[model samples]
Target chain A: MDLTADMTNQPFPTQLFGDDAIDTAEEKAKPSSRQTVGDPFVENPRMICRDVYVYYAEKCAINNVSIDVGRNEVLAMIGPSGCGKSTFLRCLNRMNDTVGTCRVEGDIRLDDMNIYDPSVDVVPLRASVGMVFQKPNPFPKSIFDNVAYGPKIHGLVSNKTELAEIVETSLTKAGLWNEVKDRLHEPGTGLSGGQQQRLCIARAIAVSPEVILMDEPCSALDPIATAKVEELIAELREQFSIVIVTHAMQQAARVSQRTAYFHLGDLIEVGPTDRIFTNPRHQLTEDYITGRFG
Target chain B: MQNTPQQSPITLRINAGLKKRYNTEKRFKRMGISAIVIAMTFLVFLFGSIISNGYTAFQQTYIQLDVSFDQTFFTGENLAAANFPGLVKKTLYSMFPDVTSRNDKKLLTQLVSSNAAFRLMGMVTKDPKLIGTTQKIWVLADDDVDMLIKGHYDRNVAESNRRINDKQLAWIDALAANGKITKKFNTQFFTSGDSREPEQAGIWGATRGSIYTLFIALALSFPIGVAAAIYLEEFAPNNGWTDLIEININNLAAVPSIIFGLLGLAIFINFWGMPRSTPLVGGLVLTLVTLPTIIIAGRAALKSVPPSIREAALGIGASKIQMVTHHVLPLAMPGMLTGTIIGMARALGETAPLLMIGMIAFIVDIPGSVTDPATVLPVQIFLWADSPERAFTEKTSAAIIMLLAFLMLMNGLAVYFRNKFERKW
Candidate 1:
């Protein structure tokens, strides 16, 4: 109940949008309306979402939020529960398309191509932009197969030996190869939670995506495993531009170059990680950091 | 405070209410265990009764003899009229050399099976050299002799009230003295076709019918059911139409199987003019009954797969189709098959639906193809059950055993697949 309380203040989506003015009602919840806000853009961005609006059936879940993911940088999106941080992350890879009623509006681009364009095939777009989830979901297969699934599907390797090499390299990048090399044929689900999370990361990386999205990847792990995954994420950012959604502000400060704060589905502040943590910003962002309220 | 809390001002103590709660919890646990035990007892009782009645059927009584097989036996052009019974009667008469009345001869021939002639003919056909041989052979004994040997016949009772009279019992005793009467495996019950004579009836025809019908049901239901489930669960928009479809599928699963029989009668036979009582037609009816079960079970199976797996697949740039086919379908296959097995088992045991589809008839020949007229094992059991002959009861029980075996075999396959493809997420 505690974990779910913040995501949805009201019990139902239908209750949130009782009438046709849901868009206007969602607009009023944004703190930007009351004060001027600083810019969150950069000169060279890898992926950009402009005036994005997401709705679940008739209810607006994320209203008029825009942010840019920088090239080869760790951009951490931190927010309380149900603030649409995870939802916004899924949109980058078009993972929301799996939901029957979830609809996304506005322009979202990866590099020069508009990913939301009708002509775009989500398969290649997803291949170019990878994602790792909070809970580890290893296919019901051997560890080696789990990691090789992406590369095999994309035909990244010309032969089995090359595929094995790609799997080894991906696992090494995810920092899981050493512990799991001898047991690559064992089920991936048999690994420790941290190791399985690393396996998912390895699976994601095997396809050689330019960007990777992680949704609270350590929330289901113990502290020790979380620390290992944190280390892995720090190392992974060097090769792939990473976007992480986390509730742990310290994790945001520790692993990110820049941090963005989301509240009530609004992007309240974005700045250098040190400045966002130390310097004062908007009242909502200040209160959130000081443990006053989510 | 922690150490002295028991003696604090609140004066906490173990009360009657707390003790009662603990007692109730224990009682609940005990009752739950008792419920499971009761259910297990019923299952054990059911299987016990069926096996006790059916096991005797697998091994039939036989009488060993040294009947001379000469060229005169097959004098007729057609072997169906071969005088193997006359020869056996003569051999029995020579063995006793004491009974000579027409009544005694008639009762003495009852010691061996009526199909004893066919048994000899089968041997001669298998080896032509036997036509001139005086080889010892074990021939099938009559069902009454079979019961007498199996200890089911009480010779102490009045001979007039019982199936075998005292004269036939005397012949059986004479044969028993020479170690001629024995219990051999009843291979004919499995190899031969249906017969008016209970002893000659075998389950092969009905077994073939069940196999064809079940395969047809599975082939028709599995793909369509799984596809419909995937569409409803993963693709269909949430609206009145899909909701109605979901409700219809759920209701269909609960609809009486007999209703499907009527539907099959009207659609497949009456309207389409398909042959009645054939496995192909029976299979179609069973498909109609099994589709809803598979669809419901397939949806549950697909639903049991966590959303995280779907997210992981989709997150890695796999298309929606890839996400479902590569991940969701494989994960759900075990459950789908388990459901399909249950549905097929239900179909295998179904008789009411087959009755309307003409599978309740007395089919004599073993069905060679799906279109040939045939009855499933349960229907064969039903027809045998309806016969007035006392000997048909054992054959009915044996057929019931055969039906049960088919059910267990299908379920065993389901369990194997469940364990084989079982995920550890």
Candidate 2:
């Protein structure tokens, strides 16, 4: 097979082709300097990822990238498919460890703790850094138990009343308590798609995590549910640091204070959401934000 | 629209094949329907033959005779050793006063089951006040007489070929004339154990043996099979060692059942010195036969649980063990139970393996526990089928019907449990 022909046929940015794919002397002379253009750091950061790389067996899924999650702020990561945004989100709590072939290297810290340290346990790490998936997933259990699962497993509450209180507060915070209060005993899976996603958010909040990672949480929801979840994200930003990966640039602009753009496993740009959307510095970021190419 | 001078070749070819296509479709449907009809016909024929041959075994022949339990012989304290058979003989003689030849008298005595004397002994032993009373009692008739009364034997062939001679038939007809012979529901068939006399035989022993053996097999195999399945599916790494183990497990499911019996004989009997011909040994052998099936089914059940549920649990702070036990296992339980029940049903009908473990013993007494020397239903059916007695032929089919009923009950339970526990999502 002609590897260069296949590479050019792919829709990926030209930087992903490596030095060998540059056939012309002029293109080889001026190599693609794959670099981030805007600031990727933040003040009062709750979590920091530095030089992180992820590989699935022989293939590099996430190239070396660094970014910070500010305290009490929603940080949106927008990228096209296969851009390593979700992979980066999963790396926050080491959820990628569940995939047997996946390998993550470099430093990622939550507060003062190195999450990937040998002495650290994933159970507690995951409890402190909770996640919501692309598709809504609720346990095959009552709505009350679905929210209370994390607190119960983590031994956050000792009594039934305390557990119920935690479940109530979590659901209320997720903006679903009013709708589901009368039917707490019904199965969570029986709820509508938006309600199930909110329930998953409630479950994450019940653990009282320092940061919440959402990987396209509204992708499976309808427009109305998406609006509701975006509103919930805005409300959630007052307490926990939120790192959300989204396919919708409008969603990223609407729900987040800061946005980071990733392309072909590279973080191309990061800045204030308005600045990234209105005045992008990187050409690839501008091209993606303007819909010239994904 | 303009019409072409000649039809397009594709349209012409399609139009030509339309009739043939419809004909093929109709022929296929007819063949499928006929296949099902033929299968149903054979099934109906089989059931008809079994029911016709075995239904008579459910009722038995009885003869009423006047017996005067004389105090001279029956003094209640010595009832156990009394000559009840002699008294029965005397009763027969008084009925046939003209027949004085010893051979004729003996032949007359053959009309009733020898167990009838034991029945009289039991009645007298229970009630001593009947000692000098001439009471009319209905007693069980011999199996040969039962066969004749049920019309299993043709009376027109010849005197030499018939099980009941002309004299016995004449006496039976004479007794019938006086309302002394009748057929009653054979409660003994359900209440008693195996006997040398077919009239006294019952299935209660083999049923209990089957229950005990299956109980042991299920109690041991279900948990072990499920546990092994969980470990191999969830905990074991995807490596060559586990791959080989998986291949071997699948291969073991296809191994002949009698091979498991030989393994049980080698491992549990000769090696472990467990008693042979007991439900315990039989159960252990059956467990070996069913383990692979249960494991395969359990793995399939575990595999069917969507991976999203597992990730959801782990995405929260639940440990791996908690994720599996709290979420995945409950979802997979209905399928696992279905597999276990199917395996148990197969174990219920298994005889060749138990035969290897000596469960084919002719055990006459009802087993009270798993360790007792016992035989299961299929083994009992097999033994009855091997017997030369004509009465045993009906017993074999009856035993088969009982086995089939048990299998249906187990499969029905499987369906009920699946419907009850299965969750949507």
Candidate 3:
């Protein structure tokens, strides 16, 4: 996790690590850049990753990387496509277990519990830590049922009215209630792309997960819908910890408190959103942010 | 080559190649349309022939005779001894008193069906008062007489080649002129059981047997097929053994249906000791034949349900089984039922397999249970088709029509289910 420490200590194979060292005086002028060395470590991280490596067969999708998703904060993972941002985010909820060839190594813990522990039942783990996909995958169900699916499957509610209450609260939290209030019985798929994505957010929230993973949740939506989802994400951070994977650097800059830049399956730098954008310690992160090369 | 036409390839090609391409496209479209027309024409021809040949079987010929059942013949000792055929022959002879020679009398007796005497006997037994009185009763005619009445034999053809000879033909003409022979709607054909006498034969027995066979087939195959399909497509890992099983299922669907018959013959009959010719045995055999097709269709149906739906269900904390049962299975049900109908339709038309299982028997009584000795419609048609009798040809066609009608109904229900469960996403 200490980018500068590892860079200075490690001997060779600089090509795999992205940079040899961060000794430039101009890069050191920025104080927030120092967090990139040790832990970008938060006072209280809801979920912590330490030297995590993900492999699909023989190919390494995520190299030795470490980051933290802090409580009541949005940690946006910004990188080019296939840079292992989504892959890393999926590991938090153990969604990658569904992929037969995917293998994850090292510690990915929710609080004190190592989530990758075999003793952990993924069904309940997923209930507690939910995910929203990149595409607006609203189930082919009614709007109300789509939100109720999680709660019903987990047996969180006693009866229909209770489920209805949960659905209403979840949709309201997602800021989709007013637009869809009159047609809750209608199919979730009938909604516009933005509404459908918000419905998916509502579906995740209905389970009352402690942490929500969004994998480029607005990539499929229009700019207007993107702004709406961004606003929702900002509002949602009050109660639930969030880890968002976005290809749009501006989206990460706008919505995240802390941003981690991934380059070629490696976490190159991590710091506060403003500092990472303005004064990236690693040359790769700086070049990427400045559109020099992705 | 390009340098030679560098003046402009587009202009040079447009004048000739464009028209040629357009003409080729037009010709291809014409060929496609012609292909459809030819296919439709064959379909029409087949249906036309079957319908024309089969519709006449729905009607049967009858002879109205003034039968004097003489109550004296039914007295205590003679009640069991009284010869019904003798009484019927005597009654017909008295009416046609002009027939004097012994051979002529024999020819005259063959005019009415052998079942006619039994029919009269049953009527008299039901109502003894009719024995004391003479009543004009309509009785079944012989297969030859029925064929003659229906014009089954070509009148222009030589008498030696036809089923009805010159003497019998004259007798039929005389009877028709006298208003004694009548062609009426064949209600008995729908009500009675199979008979060696073609005119007396009906499909009721076969229909009941088919119902039992189909019920057993559906009951055994559906749950098993669907479950196997779900397991293979959803839960089973992508392993070599799974691949082998999948390949076997596809191959099983294409296997000759008769091979299933041989399996049933070897296993169900020889090894398992299942009683031969019962619907239970036939249904079990058909289930074997139908399983592969149903499984193939079921797997395809399950596969058609998008992976996103599975992911959506799993994302909601639904267990793997729960995900399949709650979403994937329901979405795939219409397709499954459609597949089942297609499989059943094939089973319905199947004759070779059932024949191997002894469903070609000349069963007389309607089957009361699946285990009872029985014959299905297709096997019944096969049996009738093999009979040398002239009238059975029509009965065979009629049975085919009924079988096809049942299949059409099942397919219609399948379409209804498909439409009902066809989801947009």
lDDT for model 2, please: 0.89
Task: Tell me the TM-score that candidate 1 gets on chain A alone.
Answer: 0.88
Fnat of candidate 2: 0.76
Best of the candidates, lDDT = 2
Candidate 3, residue A193: CA error in Å?
Answer: 1.1
Q: Model 1 over residues B200-280: C-alpha lDDT tens digits?
A: 789999999999999999899888889999999888888999999999999999999999999999999999999999999
Model 3: runs farther than 4 Å from truth? A1-25, A28-39, B1-16, B77-82, B155-162
As for DockQ, the candidate ahead, 1 or 3, is: 3
Better of 1 and 2 by DockQ: 2
Candidate number with greatest TM-score: 2
Task: Spell out the clash pairs found in candidate 3.
Answer: A2-A37
lDDT of 2 by residue, A1-294 (tens): 344543333233434322234233243221144676566776557887777899999899888887778889999999889999999999999999989999999888887678899999999999989999999999989999999999998989999999999999999999999999999999999999999999999999999998999999999999999999999999999989999999999999999999998888888778889988886666677778889877
lDDT of 3 by residue, A1-294 (tens): 344543433233334323325546464424223223423556556777877899999899998887777889999888777788889988998888889999999888786678899898889888888889889888888999899989988999999899999999999999999999999999999999999999999999999999999998998999999999999999999999999999899999999999998877888777789878876777667778889876
Candidate 3 lDDT at A229 equals 98
Per candidate, native contacts kept equal 0.83, 0.76, 0.57
Worst 10 residues of 2 chain A by lDDT: A22-31
Candidate numbers sorted by TM-score from highest down: 2, 3, 1
